[model samples]
Target: MTQAPKADSAALSTDTANADGTADSGAETGTAAPPRPTPIRGYFERPLFDAEAIRGLQRVGVIDVGSNSVRMVVFDGAARSPAYFYNEKLLCGLGRGLAETGLLNPEGRVRALNAINRFSILAEEMDLTSLTMVATAAVREATDGEAFKTEVEMATGIEMRIIDGEEEARLSAQGVLLGWPGARGLVCDIGGSSMELGEVADNTVGRRATSPLGPFRLQQIKGGKKGLKNHIRETLTELRDKVGGDHKALYLVGGSWRALARLDMERRGYPLTVLHEYEMTPKSIRKTIDWLQDQDLSKLRNRTGTSAERMSLVPLATVVLRQLLHVFRPKRVYVSSYGIREGILFEQMPDDLRACDPLIEASRHLEEASARTPGFGRKLFDFLMPLYRNAPPDRMRLIRAACLLHDVNWRAHPDYRSESCFDTATRANLGGMDHKSRVYLGLALMNRYKNPGSNSRLTPLLSLLDPEDIRHANMLGRAMRFGAMLSVKGPNAAAEMRYYPKKEVLELILDPDRQALFGEVAQQRFSALAKSLGVSTKLRVARTAKLEVAKAELANGEAAKAETSS
Candidate 1:
């Protein structure tokens, strides 16, 4: 299970101290710099971290031993976003035959043991400060679960904490709130052996319950479809009693539920395939379930690229979902890729850290690591404040995040930079934002360099925005383009820009000496900006005694005639 060693000589170069004496990077600071890439799994075979060198980071490993899969996730940092230093999973089906045999599947037990042994070595290699293994219903309820736990512990030298159904529900609900700051909903997490229901209101967990409504358990019930429906109804009634009333949204966790959502995407040709934050109205989800009930599951399996095992469980999940919708009647349904492991991470974070905005923190990290001028983002935001000062709080947040990320991808190929920016905004492992905000931010970045409407490949994504959204995105892009020069020359030393929307005039004011920097290209871009705003342009200088309006060179030329006429 050991991997070959990876040496990051380049990263080592960044660890020296600056002239002022502060550490240049993690090396001199005696902190674990953000992890450098190692082997494919990143965590295995890395050099051990010196205890004193692991500042600002607390690496915690969570080993989830579920009925269907065994996974190990090492979270390297304790920021608002989860940074997976190392992650590996194996489908061991440790609880496959528990219902019939009344014990762990003998073959599955062996496979799981092997996986756990490998995970233990991997965890040690990662220098994981804290590594804990948590097993759910299958291991907690099985007759020989304790004996299996003893065997696993003896083999891996890692104790497994078997969590009961109720705790499982609570942890999964907490996971939802970790990604969504103020989530209010019913969290339904379907596992291989059981399903848990929990209510969350105004950022706190409410009533909760667990049931044997999982596909594996349902298959064990006597009778066919009719019997399964009756059992689901009975279980749902009890679940409703525990977690009563309608919720704003239904947060779905677990592989089977996600698989269903993915299939729903494939069926509807959803442009954004990201499962996290993907939303559905109750009616839409109900329609999908109805459509699934009559379709040939084999075709669906191929169409959605789902495994036969997962496809098989969809029917049972559909039945459970139908009943859940009927009982909860949520306004919307959302799928969260996060779950118990994220819950554990969230529980460990201090209140201040938990309260930080995940998207903004992640954007700031990207800017620090990649931008040529790191602090320029904030400066650019400050300079452009006049343009967006009237924007709503949510809109301003997205604009601020976009500013931070504006130059992070400057290293990309010139022709591909816009596409790269778009992809990163839409597809990065970002949390805490919904799909609409994701698209808005992505489109703004896309329009930053090239004109966004020209790319047909991006048309599908642009469908998420309306005309007003596109107009606003274009305006943001133009503002970024105008302010890009402020990065090269420090923001304070740069010229100022003024806008007169009522008079349909855009003006640039420069210091007399700094006027040299505003050349032909700058004027052309300024003109383009004016054109975008449907206004005329003027150039002026900040003089010793008074602001002087210089004679407009471009405005009198044929260039002005062509631009203005066009």
Candidate 2:
């Protein structure tokens, strides 16, 4: 008999090296085709050829700069799918003891820095181009985070970008799709410091939220409270009622679920302990969760079959799942081997064009997906850029991200999109943020809500902003708001538009016959922003009118040739 030629094992391994659901087959062939890789891997590596290298990245090394753990995972070079990449994790628990203490522990900080240093060296040894170090939750929450971030940069020469929870959740969804193609799954990863949840409607994290309720916090809350279980249940129940239910299939991530599976395996006297190849139903899940919940530290370490290193977190993990189950109530529960780290890796892919900022990126995607017109978004972007030319790079990114996100809510719920954009952009746990960043982006996105004013909370965040940034935001917000107004009035409009500057003033130029909202309130809002930039502005909507006439008078040159020096 002739032997079949080997296809590729590149699809077999991953950072978690979890489950391919065909380990036996994979092992037997040593080089045979994997019947299937996880949907997450395939969903993301679209145009298959574009992602073949994604699986090939097993030799690639990634470091997750998480609040609870600084994990370093490397893939075996031959793995073709992220599902097949073999990787490792280390828990630094940076958020450990930080919630009430109000500071990142020195020990934790040192551990994180050291971990990055080592990971950096490993990445170099591996000669990998795909190395990324990301910080989520704790680092973003820390007061001294910048100092610690700088320490990592100095020590490892890697910039650990602090990201928000929303972006984190989005990326995790991306990675989980590797296994769960096109399924409506509610994915939640409970970390030491935060939990990211995504609702995969139409196989995308179309809506998600990130909260401070990590396993550690959940455990602490359970221990501190009187009616712990009921408290957990009620809190989750209230959360679900308020926010809506998670998908029927609940996907769990982080070490807690992994540990739960191990305990379950021991109870059943399973033959093989390799987790990724493992599967369990709600009956088995509840059984393990119940046992873990009932146990104390002694049992967790000695009898419960959990890693000793993870002993401290088991109680919290149990309560978290317990509460979530009671509240979110999923008919199916699947353990996810992905989280902030994998999410980071998925999003940071060199080819990924998403802005990576939740509010901005989601907003931009929403804007594009929702809009029937093309130039509307570009016109908004072009109109807004000049106003922010003087803003600090950091704030500019946040505000720009908000602007991109502002028009996103137009299609599904136009009336409520401003609020939605504001909520998603601000509250979405996108990593790499400080409170100020969230507040400001939230405020900017919500410009549509309650007229702009100095007395509002978002005002402070905006107050410190470069005067020009305020002007830019104001100008762009007005134009975007107006574009939505006009887009519905029925056809006959310019698709692309821009505003050029003249002596600190801006000239608004739109496509022929574009509608600029007339009458009181809109003009008042528009004028306030224009006035802030020292530019006396007037809207010119008719196309037959010449721009050169305005430009030559106001700028002494064509708006195109005008230089913005000051």
Candidate 3:
């Protein structure tokens, strides 16, 4: 759950104290020097207070407890994608004897407990902002569920939830949907304890069902075919009727089945294999399932696909995969590289925030709008930031991405742009969204400029979304429009756009009798937005002693190319 034992440890070479927390980095500070990473002068509660100090970013760790195994993931703060820095999984089958027995065995419980303890220590030492731990079917169904949870929390200081079956299915689908673009079909999450079947249509989720035959349960049923076969048959019969014929394109998740597929591919020496984009035909899948069915537990242990700890659960996993294939008869099975961890990320977000796809619905809309007006979208966003003095720093970046993509609709046909842009962003495979949620985002984008009597195709779309998201789309849309109007001549064709704030009215130092051509309409729109958005709009043109703009290297950015070469 934790990333590392140490924080800060900035790759800095020197340090110096100031009246504020800002420090100069060097071997000498023109005075006696302290260590490089020490808190600066006059800073109380250095980590939390220090008004002028460098604030640290927060990280969240997501842990998943499954029937076959448990895993932990840490997303790094510094990386561009906030890439994964630590990922570890252990297979401790509390579910192994669960079919015959009602609870976890003594040995299995000890092993699982030890793993949780280690994770807890790491989380503490690494200083994770928070950790979300969820126990799935194995632990949920165990008679000693509450006791097991108590032991984990007491031992590791990490509280866990034994989430219900419906919650599990919803989260599993959400996690997969977070990074899945244009994914509309069924999600079949086959775990050690149960099979969760869900649907993502137009980015909305409906009909979540958790089937009885988990890998462990199915294996037991297969082992005692004459006795437990009817149970397995009945479960599959119910699942087939629920899935019906049309929604059989499967988005496969959970470890047992993924491990099986990975092992089969590794054995066959298929060089190109990436789990998220991993593909397999029904024929290939059937052959792999058959091979797995033929093997005994010992053979499975010796096989390449089996992890050291998951050796015992092979019999159960194979049976579940075979039974599902036989009963549901899906056309294709697509492997998912994400599940509960991602779902937990979605859960942590505010409820209204979850109604739409965050990245796709928001970021794409603004980026496209900037492209149309040949405006300084980024600069305009920076200028407008004074309005968000109390907003979270992270939200600042989100607002920026939204502004950049605001004009994406301009690329499509003008009349249907709002609707089309809404559709494109949600369904275009943008990261961090499902199809229906993406639809909601698209709808929000189209309705950003909602006006009276301008609610035909857009009204039904708006009905499916959260009201706040619609408001956000408008705020973002206004900023984009303001930025565009500033470019009256269109993309440097001429300098018709002029900016002058009411507080600092235009004062030219040109010839006393001369006046430059400044468009009145553009100026009026600029003033309106400045008042509306509460931004200080500024522009000045005067004869100065210096004739050309200077090129200087910035503290963070490099100098202009002409200056660099010189």
Candidate 4:
């Protein structure tokens, strides 16, 4: 496989921070510059990839020619996480007949080749200096796979890397780790012709095993239910030996599994529709898979809004999933929207690039692209630091992220900014966040715009948070609201905050020149900040240094005269 020049996965968004402390309105680059890693109190920080890696080739692209879909994804800039600049997929079942004929489907092959040619032209038009094409499963198993690879290269001037099952499993597992840096469990990646299982822990890939358990393969099994069961059980024996029947988590990768999870979401009326990181307990998944066995899949297709072709494979995939849960008894099953493309992206990233914090880099990217003042996010954070003086390291990072993103959504319609802000934080393809932390950030952003009413639709996600978390979110929001308004003249113009915990007083000391800008609305926001802090508020004009300097000079003159007279 050819390695593309590793593009630093920094924020690709062209939101440049200007010298005047304002965000420049450049074309939105899908990437952002990451925040410098400062060693937070009581926490260790790792350096990020050097800027030189991303300097020449800021954007990279990959074409994934898979069994079920032939797609092209352009990742802009670089960072530990993927920032998609362009993505397109064509569902051509290139592996549709591989099980029966041991050859790529004739019609599907034509469609895939045409798609590849078009993708090649598009990549050329886009001038993707670092583009790589990878083919999986179907191509690997097909009788004329090498000839097909040759044809593709001759026609498109691009050599496709046909990855074998083991490499495929390794890349899929790496994708899981890319999204979940702390993932410690099994990764089940289902494809058209095969399913690959691998173990990952402590940020490293572990044992890997591949099986002919894909839905397409199951469709061609000699036996029906019994045979399918026997085949799955027999095939997974090696996997069982390697991974054991322990209750570790299982990270699901593949379109079919995500479709199944989406169906479950529809069946349960789940509020958040974001698929990546969507988790289900073994019992819940078992129930859903069992229930799927009886439901009218046609109607289920309509309800869940999944394609018929995709739904057709659900039952087969469900059987495999059921057996997976029963055999592995995983504690939880998480779906990853990222797979080979993301893994390809991850493979190119330098170690420092892989270590950068995903959430902060993303927020900083948004701030650079959309905020009225880019640098003010840091100012706002510093201004409110007194409020979070004792915040734990994790809490402090979240706060800093919230501050950076405080104004990124202002471009949203005034009526929808709050909800939009919440959705952006919770649903964006951010890394290193759990469901609870995602909701917490969303709620904080929601409150940053306006108070969340009791009956807000967002209340369902609140189940993940307690009162203290909500209170803390509100404090950050209120502080952001005040700081935002105060920093309209840039961060330097914002008033300094002084907190006296014993006195229970929160003071806003304004520069005299900036006093007029502090008006009724500002006062109201300051009061809200004080209320959130459970403290009394004081608004004072700071004394000028010139007066103190003159007084000291006069005293010095008097002292000199006294000495001379003596």
> Candidate 3: global Cα-lDDT?
0.52
**Relative to the true structure, how large is the alpha-carbon lDDT of every model?**
0.70, 0.53, 0.52, 0.73
Give the clash count for each candidate.
0, 37, 21, 13
RMSD to the hidden true structure, all candidates: 12.5, 21.4, 18.7, 10.0
lDDT of 1 by residue, 1-566 (tens): 22111221121112110000000000101111111111122111111221233333467677889887788888766655676777777777777878898888788888888899889888887776667678887899899999989988877777678877777887788777767666677888898899988787655567778898878788798878888788888888888888886666788888888888887776677788777867776676777888886889898788777787777788878888888888777767778887887776666555555556666767776776799976567667766776676787678878888888889889999988988888878888776666667777888787778775664587787666667888788778777877776437443345667777788887777767666777776677677777877889887777733322322331243355356436
Candidate 2 C-alpha lDDT tens digits along 1-566: 11111221121111211111111100110111111212232111122212455444445455677766677765333121232243555677788877777678779888777777777876777666455565778888888888888888777766566667776666666555433333365777777788777666443456667776776555556446456676666666655653469467676667766777667766665433444323455666678777655656566457645567576676667667767876777766655554544444444333332212222333344444455642244444444565556656565556555545555555546566565655554444232333334445555666644345666533434433456555555544554454444433211233323334555555555444334434465456556556645567755664455633433343442233234221
Q: After superposition, how far is residue 522 of candidate 1 from its true place, in Å?
A: 2.5
Error of 2 at 98 (Å): 0.8
Please, what are the lDDT tens digits per residue for candidate 4 over residues 116-141?
A: 99988888888785787888889999
Best by TM-score: 4
Estimate the TM-score for candidate 1: 0.84
Q: Write the per-residue lDDT of candidate 3 for residues 325-389, one digit (tens) a residue.
A: 67767666666666666665544433333333334233433343346642234445544454455
- Largest lDDT belongs to which candidate? 4
Candidate 4 wrongly placed segments (more than 4 Å): 1-50, 243-247, 455-464, 489-493, 500-504, 538-566
Give the winner by TM-score: 1 or 3: 1
Could you arrange the candidates by lDDT from highest to lowest? 4, 1, 2, 3
